[model samples]
Target: MSTVTGSTTAAISSAVATTTAAAQASVQAAAQSIISGSTNSSMDTSSLVTALVNSKTAGQAATIAAEQTADNTLISAYGTLSAGLSALQAAILPLSDGATLNTFKTTLSGTGVTATAATGAVAGSYSLNVAQVATSQVLTSAGYNASTNLASGSATMTLTVNGQSSTISLNSSNSSIAGIASAINSANDNPGVTATVVTGSDGAHLVLQSNSTGASSGISIAISDSTSTDDLNKLAVTTTAGKSISSASDLTGTDSSGNTINPSQSTISGTGWTQTQAAQDSYFTLGGVGVSSSTNAVNTALSGVTLNLTSAAVGTTQTLTVAQDTSAESSAIDNFVTVYNTLVTTMGSLTTYNASSTSQGVLLGDSTLSVIQNQLAKIVGSGVGSGTTKTTLAAIGITLQADGTLSVDDTTLNAALQNNQSAVTSLFNPTTGIAAQLDDSITNYTSSGGIIQNRTDAINSDLTSLSNQQTTLTAWQAQLTSQYTAQFTALDTLMATMNNNSQYLTQLFGGTNSAGALATNKG
Candidate 1:
């Protein structure tokens, strides 16, 4: 009875072991299937491709268009001043063989001025004293009407220069020491004489000054009006010319059109060159309204110049010369045209249609770009151009083509340049011409939302989607791993128990009955 029961148990154990092994294989197989199908990377790249279909592709094309537009703007701007550019660029470079910075000492001097302080900042006649006016301090000067205001208050004021005498009037309110000073300086306007109430420890005193530095430039002031009076209207002034012979006077120059040029404002003259002074020049106004005794002109004394407020004098006007980068401007113009021509040729070639198959090129058939290109052509053709100096594109190397593209007809351009230099110089100079407009247009296309924007946006959007998908996929993978682990572990435990019982039962039989052993046993 024991033998028969043991044999039956052994058979049962063997059957269960085989079943457990099969179950493990099934569990693992299922796990693998789940893992394979559940991986998030399994999503096709085709979907990403689909999402990037339209404007993204167009944006890539826009980069090329944008470059062409930039080229056009530069070239159009360059045409008017091509020749000067190379020289200007070269001159800007220092002898150090690289971009070099240089420090320079500049001195201001003219014929009529005496500088008290030679260097650094000192109290001054002129107040270059930089005062930051509070926004609130800006008195709306335009609203004040000078007609009703008292001019000056003083009795009889007489001025004599080299025995030439003039009668002057003065009002009390307008001719306080400050008013008399103002009137004296105002009377000496043509002679460059300036006056002001000089305040000292004692009290306020009327002081006279001149615009020139030399002995011939010294001016004398005599306050003939004993009673305080308004004295501004007392002196006579010449209509067109300025002659400051006294220390209180200042120099004034005017263009042929009678536009007065103040030394304080203009850096250059009509010819575009800096002014050269053999001696110092002085600036002054009456009653200290704009005059001062400090060595400085406005606030601090100007270097290389000396000013003396000894008396008032008529001052001479010095012609101003403007600084010009003619050579650099010329070269810049030439480079611009070159870039422009190259740009258009390149763009048209890239964007034009191919007579054959489905191979469309960059910017091909882009209508908006075509319009922009035409606009550039017009600028190169006949937009705002510099007058006289460089007025035409052909004067440079740029030539307009029948097809709306421009070319560097070097020979024609060189001739135009040689024959009419100013016309060529005026062509693309943006300061007053078409180049400015075209440059502005180019700016519009490259900014945010320009051609490159859409493509960049698409790439960013796609990357964001990819990141989200990865997160979700990673979570799915974790779940799959857990499921796989649990299923395999259960199978492993069952298999181990089954194999142990099968071995024990088989051993108990000693060698089970021949047929049963043969069916279940392994070699």
Candidate 2:
């Protein structure tokens, strides 16, 4: 027992001395009770066994608990450190890649025209005059009854738009005007065409409109009906190339019968189609040079800039000015500084040690945290390059403070972003920027299989070991309790028998001055 106790004590030398002393005192008290009670009555065997078992296992149990607590604290501390590093990484990613620094903004002087500038757009001012906005071709057929059958037996209607054609089978089931419109809309292979029925004062007019805007996106329909003179033949029309019509007068004024023509109604002439609206391209001028676009959104006219023109922009001249966005850049840099300072503060609290109060942080002497702090400080305090052209955070009004946090001067930062954009770009270059370096370091520290994860894994392993040790100690304690209980109970029975025997002997053979039965018989 002494050898086992010595070995256990040496293994858990860091266990609290008071706990071990208390266990020892309990065992001593139980032993004293047995010794003093030998002359009086049988000892409390159950309490003696419990005290002995507790004395043997108390140090090991306390050691396991303390070590497990320390390991858990370390694990939690690593989690906190990892979280701080991740937040800092998120704040610096955009700056590191130069996405935040290279942003551009566009200013337009007139209404109905909006412009957006992206990367590669140069700073400049240009005059833009929009002559016409693009429109889609809309063709309406002659008026017909809503329920009138347009086709007889099996027939096929092929609709073409923008050089792409789709043939939909039109039979007696879907030969009506409304049925034809529904078939056209539900056709899976439709080539950008929408059909609708407009109920005017005359009757229902089948309207076919191109789904796209441009000169080539005109709608044309061809029908092969069972009969030559079927009503479906009236729906057959050929595409007409769009022309620039400035006013209603530019359209055909009269039909062959000298009747005043209604341009809104379909008057199938030689082309077999009526053009309610032309499929003309958008016409605009940039810097006094004429340009045409198939859509209102003209992206090809300017490098890295898209111009959105509305109908109201026609015949109006607007000024488009492109410049770098300074405010966004400033905000991004400021956010980076703020997040970095927060990380620094968190790290300080984790690793601080108070000498006067004798209170230490959970990770006060952790080497991993120390190394991480040193690496970050080295990068932040150093400059990107050497010589006069070199730039640093200090040059951009971001300074490292005595307490390892950062301070930003907004006025200086804005000035640097506005005037010295090149230097700023160089400092935040995608490859060698300070933010990029910091991001890389943080990734290494916080990523899977990184330092923090490895440390946490090690601590968890220590906890598992402590649990196993605790399990073994509990088993030993149970075994020791059983053995002690048996031995003490047997000793208690023997002592009780001996005490009873002494009383019997005193009664039979009288002591000192008392006569016994044996003495009386001898006299």
Candidate 3:
């Protein structure tokens, strides 16, 4: 408690001890207040710390913003390029297949028949007259009690189909009618025959039918057994008529008037089995020439045409026409043109500059993109064949437009296909075709380790680097905040002590500066 104001200033100055020049200046200003004995003063530490931290980290924030923009643009570019290349690949797949080009289309004028023409079929029209279609052999065994076992001990049955024979064993272990039917159906080598046990109100009857549809493909069954010959022989059947019973049995019948009477009924079973329906070849005529087929699907009667007989009306005639499938060929070329245009448009967007954004595209100046664009333009216009009438894509229907997209002239393409189909096909030859060349070019960019993949990987690496940089910037900002907060708090503490000392000095002495009063009083 000194009456001299200069002594109060000396005490406050001695308390202000700090290494930073700014912190020292703040403490000195507080000392001056004590000499003047003033109390209306404040040190806003919170506001000062906020300002200092912001100023220190502004450069890093700007860097982060720029990096984020670049990362977003690059990611978008990869997606656009990948989708564009995949679409181009799908558009040219049909033209790349040789089988599709050689395929012949067939048409039928009559509802009685359908036709399919194979590869290399000559373009021609022929009249077809179906006399009778092929029929399969059918045989039914005598109705037996379904629960009864028909065979005793062991017996072997031989089944023949289309001149091929397979033997099935019949024994007490599989002697039931159901068991025997299952055994015949499950036979590993059984050819063109299926055995089934059909149940009716009378009983269960074993029905054996030929899987094929001709006399040469009929089924023949024979039993080799010494015992139970009567039961085993019942399963045997022959296509040669009259070898077994084909006679009528008297059955109870009901008339439309509801009167019960005796009616003659034909039975297909006896001591042995006989054919109910004989296997016969299909009879038809091609261009008034007689022909025969063992099956309804007639393949060999014509050179490359296969006729399937649906219904046989002896007097009816149908027309079968085989011709080049020009529509299919044209459609394939059209698809290729469409996909090419899509790819070109996407690439243009990715490489174009946007004045609104004041920025160029992410891939604007990429050398790889330039290479892809130049190569694609060259491929569509170049000639693709040597010994062909149509040499280039432009010679046909597909031609490049001013905007780097492909356009098709359908009339021109169809004429080329109609005139020399081989030459048109050669233009898309698997070895050196327009479609092949385009496919090759697209694969270079879309396949593994391609240019697009490499570029994507580089962008990903850059994103990783950016993430690391953001982390480092965040840590640097945190450190700066801690440093600023500590310095301002220290300065505020010095100023508050100085203010308290000044108030005490003014109460003991006066509110105004008293340095001159102290010197005169000392004199």
Please give the CA lDDT of all the candidate structures: 0.40, 0.79, 0.70
Clashes of each: 123, 0, 0
Assess every candidate by TM-score: 0.32, 0.88, 0.73
Between candidates 1 and 2, the one scoring higher on TM-score is: 2
What lDDT does candidate 1 reach at residue 133? Answer: 11
Ranking by TM-score: 2, 3, 1
Residue 243 CA error for candidate 3 (Å)? 19
Can you list the residue pairs that collide in candidate 3? none
> Clash number for model 2?
0
What is candidate 3's lDDT per residue for 1-523, written digit by digit as tens? 1111221232233332211334444445544533343345565555555556555555455555455556566667777888887888788888875555766789877776788877768788888777666778777776777877777777888887767888988876676778878888898998878888888887777778889876566666788877755477777665432211111122245758988632321123345555566666667788767776667898887777888886545457888789988787788878888888988988898788655654455577677778988988887877674554448777787788898998888888888988967667778887778778878878888888998888777767777777788788889878987887797677667767888887777656666565443445665
Scored against the true structure, residue 238 in model 1 reaches a CA lDDT of 18
Cα error, residue 45 of model 2, in Å, equals 3.1
Higher TM-score: candidate 2 or 3? Answer: 2
lDDT of 2 at 169: 87
Q: Please give, for residues 1-523, the per-residue lDDT of candidate 1 as tens digits.
A: 0111121233334444555555455445444533432332132222222222311222322332333333333333332222232332233233112111111222223343333332242222332211111010000001112233334334555643333544456654564556545665666433554555445554554444444332233232334444334233322121111242233323346757889754222121121111221123334543233333322233333442334432222333221111222343445555555556556666565455555644343445444456657766666677443454335565556667786655676566556544654554354343544455455545454346753334334434544554565466556545655654565456555555666676666665544443344445647
Sorting all predicted structures by lDDT, with the top scorer first, yields 2, 3, 1
Please give the distance, in angstroms, between residue 306's alpha carbon in candidate 3 and its true position after superposition: 4.2
